[model samples]
Target: MPNCHCFWSHIWNISGGVGEMGANMNSIIEEERVRGGVFKDINPEDEDQQPTVIESLCMNCYENGSTRLLFTKIPFFKEIIISSFTCPHCNWTNTEIQSAGRIQEQGVLYTLQVKTKEDMNREVVKSDSASTRIPQLDFEIPAFTQKGSLSTIEGLLDRAVAGLEQDQPIRKATDPAVAEKIEEFIERLKKLKKVEEEFTLIIDDPSGNSFIENPSAPQKDTALTVTHYKRTPEHNAVLGIEEEEDDRKPVNDLDTMRNEVLVFNTNCPECNAPANTNMKLVQIPHFKEVIIMATNCDSCRHRTNEVKSGGATEELGTRITLHLTDPSDMSRDLLKSETCSVLIPELEFELGMAALGGKFTTLEGLLKDIKDLIVSKNPFMCGDSSTADRAGKLELFGQKIDKIIAGEMDVHVILDDPAGNSYLQNVYAPDPDPEMKIEKYTRTFEQNEDLGLNDMKTEGYAEK
Candidate 1:
């Protein structure tokens, strides 16, 4: 029987019919592992079980609504989208947490992080992860007792004190860490003052705007009283004391100041090639209004706004008065909407006339509004020949308009032509009577004699 069993087992192995047997052995091993609580394989009966998915919540304890949310799944790890989160109530976002990965078949998953929250006088930090938010951690900021003035901490005390006169020195006494030193100095001063009356020189830092009121005065301990003294011309004008003028470094046109140029590129609704659009505005100083301008592509005539935040140092005076001007600055109201209209009533015009249009009001105000619009557009027109021509024509018109405003020339009124003949004609009107032009006379200098020199030798020789 034993020989027969061995023969049957050898036949089964040789025929490759031992699949279930090996699986059964693995199952037994897995069972043993499960009994030891270390098994991770799924049973045949539990094959329908799905991986767990969890949604990450904001770690901020005091507030809700985060732009970041992560969907994590166990079993098979995966990742999804990373997006911005903002609180609906306070519009505050949890910048600490970020979307790390996404779980398969589940929602997006985000990485956990710590966040800061301020309550009354305390700031709290909390660590949180997807599906689990931890308690806020309590911490304290150590108070400093170092003795120094505000300028000292700001690294300007030495330079400021150096500029003060010897008779009047600027002294700064900060916290009580230097209390003993201050007391010793005070005692020495008192003794010296008793020996020499009026010999006590009170030193003050002219450059230092703050003052240390009574270092030993307990009643005014909490009170940080500071006196700001303006730099007087008389004080700075003293002999041998040259007030150092701040050397303002020259600013680069392209690099200086803060100006952001955003080029919005899109195809023209009409022609789908390349289109640049922007709406730029000059933040006029002390003015509540902004100027808007736009430009269009030359190829397709596709119009769009070009915006630029360019900083100009030019001084813009207030629009204090607006009265009647000339007809040079007036223009027809072409605005499609009343909201786009900027014509003010009883304002001056470029033509040295008051704007009394068919319906519009002041043309100067309207011109200003147009200027604002043009600036807002900041349109980067194509460098095509056609665009260049258009830009040239526009520039010519601008020059002519400026001349008209300066009362140097008049804007010739002409019928509109599709060929842009009117712009050219208005831009360049040749003098009809060229022959009637005035000619400037010049002295026919006969070498040095034509200079009209009153030489004594020449006069005597001529008389002789």
Candidate 2:
């Protein structure tokens, strides 16, 4: 029998088996990223010493919020007009046909459609003429790209609030009518504050053919025209910064930083009454690297600090078996028949032969029989019917009758839930086995209540 055992092991050292350690390792990597918050892989300060011209990253520069300046030898009128700017961020393309005299005066049009990437695709001369034709040429420019904004803590919180509001239901969790009223209230609140910022580039094409070279000195060559546009935050809150506020915090003020530190009150082991404690001075096992500060209330002297972890298991340490079967009167013949191919939707199974005392010839044959049984019966069984139990025997049977035609077959499926602890195995399957014994621990019910001052709370939960 071929053995392919994939399990998660808490390795003391970094060296781990190829497939075995993958899932666990990924969890560790994700945890680090979250704790560190947003990180920039490239150093922004060291950009000056790097090469100025980049070919593959022309469109990418504008998309990433960087300005590109270009300079090239002109063919006509002391300076030739370039067609457009391609935004690497949003793929917005733009064109600015400047009269060499205008570019030197405006220092390159930072705003507007003609100078922006979008205007490049728009037709310039709305003419029914046969003589005028467009010209295309290449020019070189010095260009540089840099990230525009670094988000602050307040900005992150504001974004999180926006996200929360989107997922909020229109109706109350308990009362449908109340939920609708709350939703309406939220809509009104949105319109009143108008917290969201909008940015737009406007371009005017006079003669139509508007081509512009890079305006910034950094990227004069390849950073010429941007063809795409990316949505940018007009005002992003900078971290480690503070802003003046009114008596109450504004609804749309995502950039406002909070000055007060977060404080949590909990029961303390020694005394529970608003006492501050630090995690740095404690010693603990598996969670030594995790830092948590604890405090107690001044009145009760209760202390608590160990926050519960929230994530799916980094290591399931369990193996799940999936079985497929097919059975046809010409089963042996069908085994050789490659015409009908079985497709397991939403499932990928690892197959093996001789799992049960070598009862069947090929792995595929056994699976076909099982599938056949399933088709006949709404839910087929895995061979576990053993009266004189040595080990529960796997058994499956199927029957189908149409008019004078009758078809019947049997197949079996058996599995071991790693530690005999996976009680909710069927719930995890995309479409679980119907015959498998399962128990429910919760009943369905509903209720409605209202608190004064428009305060409300509603919840729903399920269990197996």
Candidate with top lDDT is 1
After the best TM-score superposition of candidate 2, give how far the Cα of residue 119 lies from its true spot, in angstroms.
Answer: 22
State each model's CA lDDT, in order.
0.29, 0.28
lDDT of 2 by residue, 175-221 (tens): 67776754665554343234232222222222222333233324332
Please give each candidate's TM-score: 0.20, 0.15
| lDDT string, candidate 1, 1-464, tens digits | 12323322321221100011112324433444455422233332443322211223333434444332122211121121112344455444422211232211221211112111111111111112111111221111111111112111112212222323222322334434455544454454344323332221121333221122222234432222323345455434421236455454434333322254445676666777777765433343322223234546768776643222232211211111222234533442211111111222322222211121111223434444344333333263333433666667555545544444454553332211111101111111244322112112222233113222323253457563
